[model samples]
Target: MAQIDTIIASPSPVECRRLQNILEKEPDFRILAQARDLSQTYTATEALSPAIVLISQSFAALPEFEVMHMLFRVLDTRWLVIENGDACTPHLKITRNSDLFTIDLRSGGAGLVPLIRSVTRAQRRKMVPARPVRQSMPGQKKLVMIGASTGGVDALATLLSGFPTDCPPTMIVQHTRHSFGGSLIGLLDRQCAAHVMPAKDRMRLDPGTICIAAGGRAHMQLAISHAPQVRLVPSAPVSGHLPSVDAMFHSALRVAPRTVAVLLTGMGRDGARGMLELRQAGASTLAQDEASSVVYGMPKAAWENGGAQKRIPLVDMAAEILKAASMSGEEAKP
Candidate 1:
């Protein structure tokens, strides 16, 4: 297991205790330091070199932008800003301007755990390699498969919104708790002009539509029946995940060998081997760049394994996918 160095900042003792309790639950995480003031937080992060910093809006007297700028400039650590209460604070609102930090209210602490875990998992998965892939053939309809977990809701929203309505038939495996799956789909549908739906078993690939895997009962798979279609399988978790990215990518490669497989911001290497298979099958592959990834695990693993042909930022991924798919004549029209 990989260890995470962490820093916590909160002006109040109660808030500090809450964050401390949360960190204590994760064995792989170590508290490098804690601070209640802006100056102290900046000093501690720079000296400790923590990978992530958890900060509350009430922390210190400094303005939120100053604190955020300092953290980014000094440590380059990922920041998770916890709002003080139900009402959005001015600092919290300002924090949202930067893509580097994730903002959430303290009332949503239950959701925070999963996001932290996802980042931790991503860090661990980044160390893995994607080896033993086959090369792609030229001029084939290229399928692009993507997977994300934890802070993936916002990350996916940011990445997918850039996609045009005519973007290639893209499939996504996003890790969300059961009840939130539909809401997740709804969010994406509203954000992107592209059609987004919960993937159903045996639904044929249609241009300009995005299929997202639903949680709970069914696992999404790519099935070949006359032609390739999204198939929902009732099966146990593979790689500790259902609607596994690996499963989707593996099936996509089998159905369309010369596809593009992308492993985006997520925790764990669920799609590492599948990405390798796609590479071996002569498919173009990409990983999300580390700087832009909330957690760089999945993409890093794919890159290390020699599976990724390119590593791009989240903002640019849709365009890159379109470019790659166009080479295979599967380009969606504008």
Candidate 2:
């Protein structure tokens, strides 16, 4: 068996020592580091990218804990939460998909050892690639631009579900914290037929690839190059968002005629003005109708303000997208 790298993060020195002692007994498990606070945990995780993090439940009380927690989920690390409370509590969650295991520290070595074994096994399985997948990115004259927020995650999953494996290059800006991008990519990748991944600076836009504009300090914009590429602009937040929807749509003004810009369910007016700009530039712009939207704020604004050419229901959105993208003629009106 290969050695598994693990970290212990806890506020209590006694708990840290206890975990250290337990981890040290297992030759196959290596204690890469120990963190006494949230700051150290974040730093160590980023630096080491450990296989497991034996984190205490108290660590959740630290400042900036929510931000760091979202960031940590992006990494391929299993969280073994050492809850000092009830082991038989109905709230205990130990699920493979969640990559989380909860155990009461009071239960002693019995619970911890079994959980470590289970987590390590799961980690090893995750490390093994089922198969290699390489998407052949061919440049298509057309592309799709999507801006969503609020209820964007489920909405995106539904929208991308209709995309074929070789659909046109698609880029999206979903209002989210910088650290939540990876988690979103992972969730969408599992549900979508097309290859989904985070957008990188200067990466070419090609068919069969879906670039998600999120994470980090920069906003994702279309590169001003001969061949269209993704450009990450390290600038201030626009429209109250770091990866603003308006920033992405405005960047594609030159190619708006060939782009299908859609504004989906969101709480704010971030993408409304940009969608209007694209519509005026001859892009096929559509906003999700109030009937299908969870909040109906962004799409409603777009439609009411004439930014979107039409108000489309979520169910009909996939078919409309396919029709619009495949049509060859004057801008296909939604």
Candidate 3:
């Protein structure tokens, strides 16, 4: 098997040697060169172009996030950062249940290799094309808002499976990493009958179709132009997140008179405030019960904050949403 080439960039010689010794033991990893500064690291990277660049936070000089953006955009290099055992300086922040990804030098090199492999696989998976939404005619214009995070993928699959083929137009914001949005759309498309796709700016929300919030490049929002359309607006992270659940929920309030908001499993309180606003606007709202939620943070927050009017389980969530929109019955229930 081919070894994964790497460049170690650390300010301290001791740390560099330690990392080199540890990673060298792994047959799959091959250290090409070591650099003491960003300049040397950049030169070595341009020349060696290794698969992975392992750098220490201190040697990075600039802010960690700035360095990350610069490397990702300018060099297009896949790199991992070591925070020097500082829990406050997070190494990785992305989608999925775990908000942060870190590697502890104390644990030796055992966990390091596996985590890199997982990230590499995910990067590869992100390149796969998402299944396109099959075009269909518009249905009842009533809208449905869904917010989820953490173990939301499976829960969403179960709830969406119960959606009728002609279910109301739906907008979903599931906290996820950038490139992972396409993969999530493909996953849900397979598990459910709805025509699911990544929401594009100004894309109309037709009936029987589901628009999902994307990451990385743009954040998804709602607007009423020619029709209820998805808006991909460029904006900084809100509540520490792009395509924030609160953003969507607040927008739904503008159409609350004909909207049904559903809050699912997630971490944090991103959607709680929006749900509360929706409740105040006289919109029908549902939150997944704690027993059915993965983290129960967002839903629990909404329920406690008096934003959720009905607490439903994953199995019953779809039925409740459909019923609230007057789409329930033998023909509409899945």
Candidate 4:
């Protein structure tokens, strides 16, 4: 594993020291500098050039808009913000009900473990080489399904933007807070070339579209009858997530048996079992390799459970999916 250099910034001196001490104990991580305030943070980050920056919510006091702007400008690095109690930070906000806070870091202690894990994971992504695309064989119908949680907004945007307008019809399971799903879809629609919208109940699957599952009471499933459609399964949560990846993959297995299932960066094992099922059903399955994952737990679980046929970096995923789908189509042609 590559070494991860980090800068710790907190308005409170005690919190800064505490986070620094925790970061120092990790063999893979080095505390490049500690800052007592925003001014010190700017200076330390510029001079140290750390790969990640950990900012305590105290910085949130410096005008929410200004704080976020400054944070983005100073450190073109991955940012993790520590919140006070149940309070959240505008920058690096963890969505409600996401498994981001599941780590057992001490209270008011900056949750060093999750921060370190995020940084380490970011470093891994930076190291993977791009994969070359194989020539398309013929008659292949490529499909892409993605599941994401915690930090998914930016992650999903990054993953989707690489795809062209003619890319495969993609289904996404983004674990979002209630009422936020629609806005997220709108946001993604504007950012990417493909048409992005929330999956509607009983709607026929279409090509060249991106459907996102609703975060409310409904989970998206595939109805296997003629003109296979998206079904809203109002069921219990599996693996602690609603609109679960397990549900999506299971549906894809029945509907598009040969579709490619991709388990992207997320916080847990929600997609692992389903991905394995997809593999068993003769579908090609891929997991976002650890180096490019925002949180490696999901892809790691899929890879460990023998779910992934290929583990590719995030940047190359869109091209790979296109190549694989095109090849599959050619192979199926009479």
Candidate 5:
């Protein structure tokens, strides 16, 4: 694992010292500097360029913090926000949330180390910024977006097994833990002909390769690029997920006419509204049939809300997805 350099910034001197002490105990973490105010935080960050920044919610609410945030984001610095006065942290927010996390300091500082580790791991995935979009491509491009949760591991293995080596660019958001993401990728790669890998920030989406966002500290979204790159942004959880299906689907709206969006077995309604928006934007959309889904929560919500154009069985899902993805940009629209 790469070393994680960090900056501890807080208006309170006590808070800064607290974080410095906690991080010092970790073998992987190195503190570049500690700041007593937002001003010093900016100076240290500009000089040291730390991998992560530990901050308080109070400083983040300040106007200057926003501008500094914008400047620092280009450097790939992820934030760990500390909030005071919470009875305790939310279970979902702390354990299974995005890289840019806010935890209740009132409970304890124990959550800080884990949050820092998650962000550090996420950074190693090459979270770069997206390049500017090109005007046109010689050949028409097609994209696929799939979302899954509960029982998704087996379901994804089965669905991906049917894809050809030359299949369209596909991005998937599957709910899991950050710690288990590498194993998930390895498992999917072994099961499928297409190259299955963790989604990198600004990675070019290409045919025959699949990028997955599962239990990462960031949200994976489609960004403007010649090949339509994946952009990973560290943010608060969306639809109760860090690497949320909703974020991915919503981000692809501009390319909806050339997209095929699918919702599969999941325990929540994360992709329902996003799928509906995609459908309305002329994308081809589908959901897994209840009988085929391990848990039918997400697909059911999508079907009920008129988000899915069809509900196909798991056995036929790969075939249907392939068909949609093979369509010409003009031919793919609803």
Candidate 6:
């Protein structure tokens, strides 16, 4: 069994000791380090890349907490935050922004162990390879629609890098942090031949430019017209995600005369049903094969739910896209 390493960050030495004691009881967990201050926490995290970071509420008020939070999100590290309360009624807070899970610290910390175990299980799943699969999607693709979540940054970079400067107009929806749209587009722009940028509301969909769904409290959809454009609308979260892939996929079904939908690595089933709808509407659909996904959950869900018409490896996805676009038959070997 693989063991999970952790770093405990607590402003109070007594609270740090208490967490350490509780964690020590689990055979599969190892305490890598403990920090009582911001400086120590920074040094410890840099020196030892722990799987999980247990943070006490005292650290939340400091400016350093913001930096640490960003660092953890970028590194894909799990954080569990213990609320500021005594043993009787401790609460835990978990959110997409904070990337932390809150739990009651009373009852001799019974809930802590299970939470850690669940986190470890998820991490282990990410480490494992996906099984082999084969799928086929045939269409004359005019517009390309893509959806991704975990591992999307790297996957998009690789896929777009193979695209020609004259590639078809492409729209993408990726689950990410607020204000991360610029950074993601910038990163992708550096790696790909096609221009990459954030989608502007009412901006015309142009050939050779890839528009990414803006990250925030809205769903990014397309407006039907002589010249289709991107539109951001405030709405309830669909499939547990704002800017949901499902929303984008379902929208593609409306304008499906010549479109292709591709679903990539992510967790949950947000895009599964929507992809199925696109396929039923005569649009081609593709999904990332398991072996290459950082998390196979989303693509797996899409494939299993009869949403994906083709399952392709990450290395070959770009070639496949170009092939579907009728750009070149010579590059279809992947």
User: Could you say which candidate leads in TM-score?
Assistant: 2
Q: Which of the predicted structures, 2 or 6, would earn the higher TM-score when compared with the native?
A: 2
Give the C-alpha miss distance for residue 16 in model 4, angstroms: 24
lDDT of each: 0.69, 0.75, 0.72, 0.67, 0.78, 0.73
Candidate 3: tens digits of C-alpha lDDT, residues 37-71: 76577667767766677877664423223323333
Model 5 per-residue lDDT tens digits across residues 1-334? 5789998888877777777777888898988888877767877886788888888767665433433454354456888777755343332232232345787666668677887787667643343433222222224357999999876766787798777776788999988767557656755675567789999988998887799998799999999766689999999999999999999999999988889999998888999999999999889999999988867899999999999999999999988888787777567655
For 1-334, candidate 6 gives per-residue lDDT tens digits of: 6888999988887778889888887788999998987557756875686788888766654422544564464456688777657432111121233456776565556688889778757752232221112122243347888998866766786788777766778889888766556656665665566778787788888777789874667787878798878888889999998989899888877766467789988778888999889877777778999988867888999899887878999999987776766522222222
Q: Candidate 1: misplaced stretches above 4 Å?
A: 1-140, 329-334
Report lDDT (Cα) of residue 300, candidate 6: 96
Worst 10 residues of 3 by lDDT: 90-99
Q: What is the C-alpha RMSD of each candidate to the true structure, in Å?
A: 16.0, 7.0, 8.7, 11.9, 12.5, 10.9
Best by lDDT: 5
Report clash pairs, candidate 2.
none
Model 4 C-alpha lDDT versus the unseen true structure: 0.67
Candidate 1 lDDT score at position 37: 72
Give the lowest summed-lDDT range of ten residues in model 4: 96-105
Off by over 4 Å in 4: 1-140, 329-334
What are the runs in model 3 whose C-alpha is more than 4 Å off? 1-141, 327-334
Q: Runs in model 2 with CA error above 4 Å? A: 1-141, 329-331
Total backbone collisions for each predicted model? 13, 0, 0, 11, 1, 3
- For model 5, give the 10-residue run with minimal summed lDDT: 129-138
The alpha-carbon deviation from the true structure for residue 147 of candidate 5, after best TM-score superposition, in angstroms, is 0.4
Q: Across residues 110-222, which tens digit of lDDT does each residue of candidate 4 receive?
A: 45665567644743233222222323224447667887765556667767777666567778888765555665676567657667888988876666578898476778876
**Over all chains combined, what TM-score does candidate 5 have?**
0.58
- Count clashing pairs, candidate 5: 1
